[model samples]
Target chain A: MRNSIDTGAVICSVFAAVALFGAGSLLALMGYLVLKGLWPPMRALAALIFAHSGDSLLSIWIRSLFLLLAATLLALPLAIGTGIYLSEYTRQNRARELILSNIAGLGEMPPVVYGLVGWGALAPYFGEDRQTLVIVLTASVWLLPQLIVAAYWALQEIPVSFRRDSLALGATRWQTIRWTLMPYSGRLLAAKTLEGMARVGGEAAPVIMVAAAWPDSSKQPLHILPYYLYRSLIEAVDPATTRHFGAALLLVLTSVCFQWAALRLRRTGVVAGDTLPGLRKR
Target chain B: MRDSKLVVRNLSVYYGDFQALRSINLSIPLGAATAVIGSSGAGKSSLLRALCRMNELWDNVRTEGQVLLDGQEIYGPDVDVTEVRRRVSLIARHPYPFPKSIFDNVAYGPRLHGIKDKRKLDEIVKRSLKQAGLWNEVKDRLQESALNLSPGEKARLCIARSIAVEPEVLLIDDPTYHLDPVSAAKVEDVILELKQKYTLVFATNSMQQAGRVSDYVAFLSEGALVEFGPTSEVFARPKDRRTEDYITGRFS
Candidate 1:
């Protein structure tokens, strides 16, 4: 009661004020953008979603989505296998340590390098003018490390008792992995895969080299919003800025949705290293 | 002894340089319940794991022994681990129900063993649940995720899953350890019922549990089998001082 100004409360209030100030500035910026030329942005979004002069917005969106899907589907099995092998099978062996040490670096490698690898080695296998296929292959390879790390972490979190129980029930190692292990981490898998898909959605450098070659051709195998926005924002300054804003909005929305979904999934699913959320109250 | 379903001779287990179980001779009789009772680190769990060869999962774990199931060596070089586990199923202290429907958890074992027919799987699941005394409680919500079940029901579901595989032996590690009084009583009742058909080997630290559910009792102390005989005889008259000390609460 002697010194009624509680220092802790004052400090916390200051921090809260600072946070609100930062958020306020962000809101002001967004509000200004939304208020200025709001109609053009809206119309641009409509055009992107409904119809466009160069490509059907719906078709390109579909193609981009499917490219993400196809690349992930193609590469996931191998990545998941690596993850399971690392978490479930390998012990304090050298192989595990080596792979664990190198995986993050491999995963974070420049997307351009992956594109070159796809172009030089994989292109010959698929034949000429298969740029879309090359792009898909590059994206898949680029995503491999992230997928493996995420899935391996998820696999590691599952209680060892699950595997033991499965084995005790006379299930082989593969069967236990397929049935017991997979179901436990299914949500984590989906969350990570979605997050990966979102990351791929924003990448352009690797995709631009492969996709730009046939920009005017009839066989428009791939046309992603991010790449289109990049060109529109930089090259066509006057005509495409409004459409770029819409595309930018869509990109940010997709990224945020994936992140939100991942967070929610992690909250609900039984994760390793933390007490289960459902059981926390008890 | 000659009529035993599983025989262990001079069994010893070690994790790296640290030994967990000493040379132990044990015989689990056919169609009867056998309990290995001891203190916290008495190697009861290791004995159960040894029987099913589950200990091999641990790195640097060494086992020197002979575990015979139906006159076949379980720890033999050529014996497949999955096959050994199929014959000798293990139920752990804590329940681990897959995040699936109750029916799916029970059907997992049968399905893994190549029982693909839905009707046959349903029958096995139902029968196993009935045997584990959990059928009535989970009859309606067979489709719901097993994670929703209460702790006691989860334990029973694990039992149902194990027995669904139709194993010849069950190596249970303290089914009643963490359960409420009523749940423990139910589990004990299920054990009594199960002993009539399949051999049961319980790894429990509770002396009272061994007396209640087991026909024969093996008193283990500090990883060594101190006394092994009929439950009535051992509880009435323990031959070894260590076993008597344990039973009389002299010192665990």
Candidate 2:
């Protein structure tokens, strides 16, 4: 009160400022999206979202989930392993520096670029217009660098003392990483996998390039959400398309679900120097 | 010629061409507590590290000389540095506990040397922790993470870890620098008691610690071993003027 007016007033003002800032940005974007996009399509929502189109929405949701899950399985382990190898096994040298810089550069490459590369290289080798497997392959390569970078950063954030301590205890290099490094980095690795999932899920360009898009129920090679959305937008007659909005909502919900799981795992993962049960002295 | 358990002869260490330690020679008796007393940059820690072969872990760090354990050249061409380190373990100045449970920290050394029997591991862990004077404080929390220990407890845990493998020689580099006087005194007491089982060589900046724990004392200055004798003789009646100046705190 003596220094900066009343404490209560200051607290109230700070809360007011924070609330305004928090709600202002979201309100602005949601207001714009509703006014410009969702509202413009509102009259057709019931027919577009809820109407059962035989196997249309179901097929798209299944394909998208399948591709996302498959790619995650294929890429996640390799990416995490490479990340650990680089961060722990490979000390800083000219070659290690070169490899790390290459990873960063690969991560920055656009999705479209990856699409073209996959089309030119992988698609030809595996044959084009393939099923969900090719889509998985493309997604694996596209998300690998990002996952590796995230994991590498997570491992690097681990204090060097942790490793030194492990070694000092006569733990072998691999043992130290397994017993100490991996557990400590579990949260960040899980979070990175979630980020990679989102990247893989939303990828539209690569699937389109390698897996040809057909709107017909049986012919769409992988019929992932993005590919289906693009097909309904560009090829299918706009007003007559049956399941686009529902598919969109499903994709959004799936992303949200995966993100929630990631957050939960992050909360429970081993923290830096986390104490064991029944050990907290005070 | 003295019968010594550990012999360091003409040992020189360089970190990327900057000499960290010059030609140094000292002999440490078996099952005795020897302290290296010096100021910072006095090569006390380097000498201790060379004894355990831990200095080879660094890159662009070169050493010339012989560190002998029981009269066998430890750093010789055919010697396994890993095996040497396992036989002669070191505890650093600052306590760095692994990101693991306290039990795992103490069990690590035995596990490395292929001791997988859980019951044996348990006994070693308990014995080492007890010897480090940390058993009472952490017995109930053996499964707790080592990093969660207090600074003093962490230091003690490190000592326990080093001793778990039943190493023939224990090297402690500035073992109490990060500790308070009380905790430092406690660790010093542990070190004194530990010498009965293993040859103990420690580096300490505190002359009082050297006098208190060391059966033999070696005075090091500017990367050289200036004087070496029994602790009482070195402290009570100095042979070299520099040793007297250093011991009396007239100069470091």
Candidate 3:
């Protein structure tokens, strides 16, 4: 009773089911972590992320937060600018294709590759331990491709006619971009920036390889949440060991909070899949 | 109106390896509404863009011609495309208001030209909106987002936005094509009103609209100027067969 058309439909349905199951499995994993995470004591969690005295969790959390902020400030403008140039200025061609392909390749490259690159690049000028500002900068560079892709897509979603319309109305090309494209794409760019924050915020491998342990005593950087989690789990005594789980909970919560902020932004019509009051009617 | 004369001599346009418009000669008088009517691919839009130097925006589009606005060459080396466009604004086939409040959309062009006085800007916004016939509907809600307007209102808003800058000429490319008959009629009325202050050059497929609003008619075919005269004379007795064919609906 399987007609030729029905066979294709059956195959497509099986593929769709597989895709859904894969998505559901990831969702379930995050859901489980969040469910278990809320049960921990907030005091312990705070101590884990904030306390700095002698292997205290707070110091480690602060280190990670510092690194994340440093990376964000350094990386966002370059990444967003690259995305804009590629999406707006460059005509479609081989060079554009090659750049996009490289961005995709860089996005998937292992965190350890960036760690190694950071180590080599920073060792001579900064030092060997990848744990300071250098490592954070490196990790952000690693995360740059993702931010650019997101920003590019957001910019692309704005119709070309919008730019042309403004220019036709006697606005300079830059003026048109500033007044029209930038304001419209503002939410999307912010969302993309938040995504970059989350990516750097959650990562552990690059942070571990590049970040230095506490008390170089002169210049200490790159001791972030993930690195803190690793350091506490491996180096701390049993009494202090509870901090690792707490740090894990903190990192997860930070990422979740970042995502929640992005979602809230989207809901408030600051990001993609939302429309601003300026563009909804016609 | 002293800058009334626009002279085009030996204008030719090419798209990559293909020629789109042959040697073309045309003149437009200031303060008169000229209607360019032709079939698709007749290079009507190309000619309009050429006048504004917007054709230069396309990499593959090459023009070898002289377009002079008030005896000064528009395509000359020293001419600023931005300055030319500031004097001669264009309305696209589709209407797109800037992504801003109705008041801000009207305020954009003036702001760009460094008109920082908010009160003067407000007056310009209101007056422009009034001239475009959108003031009565949107006056109270000027600060509200422009995206909330109906399609006709949005198109009028675009016109109002252009008028805010007080351009010398307004080049409208088929503003009513996508509109329903009623909205199209309303827009046409706005155009008729607008022709008093600005030199209006409008492209359209509708012969009826051309007859109604145009002071002069220039019929084009295959990228060549076929016939042109006062609107009343051309429509009543079109000299060219192509113009006759187009007017009678025998062919595009």
Provide a comma-separated list of chain B TM-scores, one per candidate. Answer: 0.98, 0.96, 0.96
Q: What DockQ would you assign to candidate 1?
A: 0.67
Tens digit of per-residue lDDT, candidate 2, span B1-252: 236999888999998878888898878988889999988898888888788876755656799998889889998889876677778888877757766689998887788778999999999999999999999999999998777788889899999998898888888889997689898888888998898888889999898889989889998888888999999999999899999999999982
Off by over 4 Å in 1: A1-37, A40-52, A55-63, A92-94, A110-128, A205-223, A236-240, A267-282
Q: Which candidate order results from sorting by DockQ in descending order?
A: 1, 3, 2
TM-score of each: 0.86, 0.85, 0.87
Clashing pairs in 1: none
DockQ of candidate 3 against the true complex: 0.62
The better candidate by TM-score, 2 or 3, is 3
Q: Candidate 3, residues A1-282: lDDT per residue as tens digits? A: 669989999999999999999968757765665454434565655554466564555666566677778777777788778877887778766888898988978877877887776666754466554446577677778878877887777677676667777777777777876777777777767776786788777887775655532334334354567876676667767753355566676687678788878777756552333233343311
Candidate 1 interface RMSD (Å): 1.2
lDDT of 2 by residue, A142-246 (tens): 888988888888787676656655565556778777877888787878887886787679768877776542223265556778877776777667554434555
Q: Write the per-residue lDDT of candidate 3 for residues B48-119, one digit (tens) a residue.
A: 888787776665778998988888998888888888887889887776776579999999889989999989
Model-by-model DockQ, in order: 0.67, 0.35, 0.62
**Candidate 1, residues A1-282: lDDT per residue as tens digits?**
635668778888999999999968755655654554256467655665678555655666667778888899988999898888888788857877788879977887877777566656676676557767877887888888889987887776677777878888888988888887898787888788788878876787776665444445445654676776676766786764566655665566567677789878877776544343332100
After superposition, the stretches of candidate 3 with alpha carbons farther than 4 Å from their true spots are A1-54, A128-131, A211-220, A234-240, A266-282, B1-4
